[model samples]
Target: MRLRRDHLIDLRPLTTSPAFARMWVGSTLAGLGGQLTIVAIMLHMYDLTASTFAVAMIAVAGLVPMIVAGLYGGMLADAFDRRRVALVAASITFASTAVLMILTWSGGETVAWLYAIAVVNSAANSVVMAARQAIVPRLIPRELLPAASALGGITMGIMVSVGPAAAGLLVAFTGYGWTYTIDLVLMSALFLGLWSLPSIRPEGAVVRPGLRSLADGWRFIRGAKNTRLQFILDIVAMTFGQPTALFPAIGAVLLGGGAITTGLLTAAIAVGAFFSSLFSGPIARYPLHGRGIERAIIAYGISIALFGAVLLAATFGLLAPDRIGEDSANIGLIALAAVALAGSGAADNVSSIYRNTMVQAAVPDAIRGRLQGLFIVVVAGGPRLGALYAGTLATVTALWFPPLLGGFVIVGLVALLVRLAPAFRAYDAARPTP
Candidate 1:
């Protein structure tokens, strides 16, 4: 097959808009810190309780507050200046991180303190993310939105790939206090991005931030079949296929690289996403976005199953497990698992590019904040739900069973949903319909 020339990332958004570049850089740095904290928190929980279910409860603890914050934050973004909204939300996150750092340093950090702080941090971040996502369209043109989304993937890619690995190393070598303190320091970078942005409010008929505004947003979702389908499909994919909560256990028990293994497994997905976004020119040019999303998600499910298979092999002693606190590496199985995760990451990033493009292109700015809020809730909250699923199911069964079975469930469900929603399957990027 002849290689396509337009497979490279487009840098126009970065070069054409200095403001976007600044925000992107600042967001990227802050996101990196955020990922560091996420991984660190998971590791910390596992250390404290030595139970996967306990670690999974971190997501459970934060889920409801995150959803509420996402909804209200979207309303705030629509009603107020998005930049200022983001700044305020970011300040909350920064303060929470600072408190976490202080607690860790004091050597008095308990599981309760961690969970409480994480819950607050998750809620605050929902607001920051809603405002940040809503502000993007105003910064760049509609046509460039896909490219911008690809750039956003790159941000996630770098953040997830580097941040987790760094957190693992930091926590493993320097201890938890230093790791949190580093995140606290890194969070300060977010201010640079928000500070440089000009005021951006909703451009059309404005709705006041309240229950009425939220109901209107929900009404829009009910009417927007394509947008709603994408959300549903994403939730299904994440709910079934995400195996993040299993990583710490996998690293410690099955895979055997301990913190390094956990970090590597988590980072593998980001590596795939980063590379896919790095070479997203073909994705940007694709017109039939719905089909693209469906195909990518199927591929994602397949990769997830493959990962489960690798884990199953390890369970069967087909691969060697590393000893605890030792440098013993299960090179073959780790490589296989990483390869599978990398495939899933690339597919998910492609799906996200199309889904994000659709929302930004088709959705009206009047209620874009709320829709994006819902989008954030789906995107961020789905994984938390997945954590609950994977954690609970794995606790009851085995790590490999959940993903192995869940992968097929994702493929079957997504195919069924597409069959039910012809409009969604027929969606075209060039002519967005929401």
Candidate 2:
């Protein structure tokens, strides 16, 4: 089991393309800031309303706008200079975040204000994400895509791991205004990154950004069976397996230790993602992306189920405290839950690496933006839907029930869908066919 030097994350992508390197660094920093705001908002919402459903609503509220932005942004990326498209989208994100910071400092922050700002931020970010992803294939050789994606996992790992933990500590000691201010400061790096990039217009036939472009992208997707199936697989895994909406409550009531526990729970997943990418050399060379995705997602589902089992055990008073509260925690149960979550994170990252590589290498550059737009939508939107599912289910049943049931559902549905899509199962990286 000893991993060799080459059996680790390849850093060639950074050296191969300076543009990609700068963008990666900037995006990583900005992503960290974004995570801070995301976790803080959730904690803030829970603090104000003390309702998990209210916290979940923050995501649900932004879903439609995000979807619209993603689709339109993709078209814009395909038709115009991608650098310009990304810059415009980044500006909107920066403005929305500034407003959020201002409201927090002015003591004018209300639930309604948070929701509205969140909606704006989410929509803007979807565009930024679509443009950014669409820009990736143009920056590096196709063979380097898997390595680039593994690098992205590292970026996400740092963002989630450091960001949430820092948010909790900052909110606990320094207050909400300072946390928002820090995020606003970090966001400036994104502008630098996007500003320095050279103009990149889409290759091949270009269609203007409009209804016709949308229909064109749709037509391409209809024929891209592998791409379509991967999207469906991702939706199934995320919708049923995500249990993030319950973190605040889980920390307060189930695991105890309040904001700190919530941060720890959130960070554990990213920790696993980080380590998985750290050792992803073999994964980058793997040719069977479709099968890799299937197997990885199945493992993800199992890990989620294990997490649910841990929560169920806590419910049964196994290694739990007689009296659990914000200050008092069942440390053992918390540890077990973190381990399960970490497993889920690692598995999910593996799945993401395969999925991303497939899309980037297989899809045509002319239409890449539009497909990536749909990709980003599914990635972002699925979690929102999962939050709704988790929040509602937890509200009706118990904190432990949602993940417990949802995990099995993810396993069953993903397996069934893959079985039905033989082409996906046979997908080969050497000759990618979308």
Candidate 3:
């Protein structure tokens, strides 16, 4: 296929709005730092407790609080200036990272302290994320939303690809204190992004940030069939398809390269996301967003199933038994697993592009913050649930079983949901309607 320049990631958003560009750069850097802290916390928890379950608990602990913060933060974005709301959220994250660094540097780090700080950080970051997403639509035209989302994907791709790799190395060479310190330093970029933006209060009738306001957002969502379906579809995709928490175990028991394998597996997904965004010209041109999301999620489910198949193959003695240990690596199985993960990553990014575009285009500006808050909750919460699902299932059955079964579940459930939502299947980007 002959690729045209327009098929690539459109850079119009960057040139059109300097504020958006600065925010994009700042958000990207800050996000990279956030990833560092996330990976570091997991490694730190594992070191402190020496248990994978304990590490998993870190995410589980933060899930509820994060949901709360996302909802409240979205309200705040709608009520006050979005710039201020984002700055406040970013400050909270900065302070949390600083505290984390201090604890590590002063030799006062403990499992409880780690858990407490991590939960706080997660809650704060969710707010920042919601505010940021809400702000993007304000900065660019509706037609350019897909491009902006693709840019977001590139930012996420870089963060995930580099941050974890950096975390592993920094932890190995410098120590946890230095690693945390680096994140604290990198977070300064976020201030620049938020500072450059103008005050952006939500248009239309503003409401107080309370249950009533939240209920109003819910009312809108309830009435908006296509929007509701997109949310449900995303949850289905994330809940059943996400298998991130199993990477360490997969690397140690199944793929046999320990941290290196885990890093590779994680980065492979990010690489796919990055490449997909880099060549997102084709993605941005597509107008049938509903069908696009449907097809993309199905592909995502298939890729996850393929990854499960690879793991199952390893269990069936496709790889040498002796090579199935941290000390002895199975290069071939690791390669296959990475390929499958990459495929999943690519498909998931495509779904996200369409889903985000639909939300930004269809929803009213007045309630966009609240809806975005709920969107953040679904996006953040679904993966945590998936992590729990994968970990529990793997512990109960075998490492290969969770993704294998979960993948099929995603495929089946998503198909059914899309079938039931006929309007979603007919959604057109040219005439976006909630």
Candidate 4:
């Protein structure tokens, strides 16, 4: 009930553990660098081929491979030492990035080469991500799960906010080579972070990596009523409601603000996440874990609806531009949408705290990595799928239409799902049985 600032902080698992703290520091920088490289790659690919579709394919090309990497990486984590798995994955990334930098600097600008290396980079990053996520619980107490997740939110907030912006400026001023070089340097920290940790072997029996393993994970998930429901619910919310892919169009047309609006909108969500984590560390220590998740998701839906309202208001011209400083591209509408977005970010952070704790606490350590790999697949792949949904709807309907519909659908769907899953509703925090 009483939400302390550290309650917010402690909501994340990484904050309570010193070792995780160090790892977070490294991962945060590396995450930012990775984002920089990602945006840079998109831009570079576009510059070479001048096809947005081709640029989109870069992610598509890597999608299956990334999923494979995540799944197989989980297998490796479960079967072998987590530290070694992470190190090997990180090494793959580091080496791939170095090659990217070399290619960029050597005046080789083949679109094919870009696509090839991008696949390598994305696949490696995905595996490294799965391995790192599985490694989190080993560093902290069970009570610190929320705190660790909050720390992850902070890391995500900063990296996602800062990385793209920096990459844009760097690419605009200097070149893509510089961006790739920065990534190479930043990736070194991940190696150190992972390499320094002691070997973290799985706590329970290990399964071989394949179809059987996937089936076992599914069986394990089926028995986990709360876990299964949460994942399904999240898939619904993320698949239907995620409108990040439509940001550029929202800014350019529906919102009528442009790239600055797009960038600001994206960054505002991250800012909210940063503050949410800052406040959530202690909030994570609440009495009602399951109910907390439900309330948070409902709040998230409300926030999303508010975002839709802002978009609709902009489209309808109810809010005057000149009065709200429309001269510099009507930042008033942008600010209003930002508030909604920020609220969404906060609510989502809260939900993440519960969801992550549920996943880590409910599952055994031996299966945690593999399960987390699947979780990573969900986490990583959801946005790309969202991109498809948003892009398709935006092309046919309107840019703002998807968000407008998405918000309402999320509210209705999540509410209904939460109601259906009574066990999740009764999930207790102190004796987390989810």
On TM-score, the candidate that comes out on top is: 2
Selected candidate, larger TM-score, 1 vs 4: 1
**Which has the better TM-score: candidate 3, or candidate 4?**
3
Write the candidate numbers in order of decreasing lDDT.
2, 1, 3, 4
Query: Tens-digit lDDT track for model 4 on 1-434?
Result: 56343353653344456667777888988888887787777667756764445555676677788888888888777888888888888888888888889988999768888888888887787778777888887888877777778788888788766776677678767889999999878877877777777778888777777787777777887788887777776666676666665665565456654444555676677777788878774566775667787788777777877887787787777554643221245567778988888888777777777888788887888788877887777776765666566667767776667777877888888889889888788898777674
Error of 3 at 146 (Å): 0.9
- Model 1, 12-36: lDDT tens digits are 9999889999999999999999999
lDDT of 1: 0.91
**Residue pairs with clashing backbones, model 3:** 7-281, 8-281
The CA lDDT of each predicted structure is: 0.91, 0.91, 0.86, 0.75
lDDT of 4 at 95: 84
lDDT of 2 by residue, 8-117 (tens): 99999999999999999999999999989999999999999999999999999999999999999999989999999999989988898899899999999999989998
- Model 3 alpha-carbon drift over 4 Å, by segment: 321-327
Candidate 3 accuracy as lDDT: 0.86
Task: Please say which candidate is ahead in lDDT: 2 or 3.
Answer: 2
- Worst 10-residue lDDT window for candidate 2 reads 1-10
- Model 4 segments more than 4 A misplaced: 1-8, 11-16, 42-61, 105-107, 110-118, 251-259, 316-328
